[model samples]
Target: MSEKIALGNWGEELVAKKARCPKCKNAKTLKKLTQNFKCADLICDFCGFVAQVKTSSTNDINTLPNSILGAAWGPQKERMDAGIYTSLFVVLRSKSDKNYSIFFLPSELQVPEMFVAREPLSGNAKRAGWQGFLIDTTLVADRFVRLI
Candidate 1:
């Protein structure tokens, strides 16, 4: 059997683990879990934060220089023992058993640095604080929040 093949560079760039988890300050433990990046330390769970999470990163989402095209959302669990905060609010979801889902911004818009949008009937609001979300703006205006 004979096969013919032809191609240049597949018009692709390798995602060479170009980033690190700001919470744990870890780079070697990054793992691509589906579309989101997960921490390799299954037990650590210090932060199951997204790896190449573009929307959350300061360089991508913050400095868009236009309407807020989009934003990343994730829930974090409390890890008080781990000496770090965790994700708990279901930001991108409804009152269901499923996990959070990603939402898109069709147009550019401005959102408050401390934006917290939630459902009207989501019971989670009572349990979790204002935004079960975290934004480490203590050091910088657009730093990532500690999530799990």
Candidate 2:
């Protein structure tokens, strides 16, 4: 598997093993959903809470980045337009020591300005015309809850 995929999987596993559902506070309730699930990676089996996970390797494990890359822009835009937001779990992994941290950004703390649409892919690319978004963490930096 690709390094990106492996990193993401590792982060997901850490979340599954460590973090409990914020809504229900149930242990081991977060289950990995199918990749096809739009904008969500894990779901709370007990409380039905769904969240999106973004994993990144960084040199500074103590600090959260200014922005986190998000998945498809279409669904994100649609959800924003409808006033629907998903909870975001940001997993920061250290590049040197492989240590990691988890930060939870609740849906209630999210705003429209935080979702920045990225440019579409080039026509020659495999997923040509596909677009993504970036979650501007700077906008809600103070609102994130450190889960780990």
Q: Number of the top candidate by lDDT?
A: 2
RMSD of each: 15.0, 0.9
Q: How do all models score by TM-score? A: 0.26, 0.97
lDDT of 2 by residue, 13-109 (tens): 7898899999999999999998668989999999899998899999997899998888899999998899999998999999999688999999999
Runs in model 1 lying further than 4 Å from the true structure: 1-16, 36-47, 50-52, 55-63, 71-148
User: Could you give candidate 1's per-residue lDDT for residues 13-98 as a string of tens digits?
Assistant: 11113323444766555443432223111111346553222222123221222222112233322222233332211112222333
The TM-score obtained by model 1 is: 0.26
Q: Number of clashes in every candidate structure?
A: 6, 0
lDDT of 1 at 18: 31
Report clash pairs, candidate 1. 67-108, 67-109, 68-109, 76-87, 76-88, 77-87
Could you tell me the lDDT of residue 119 within candidate 1?
30
Candidate with maximal TM-score: 2
Each model's lDDT comes to 0.27, 0.91
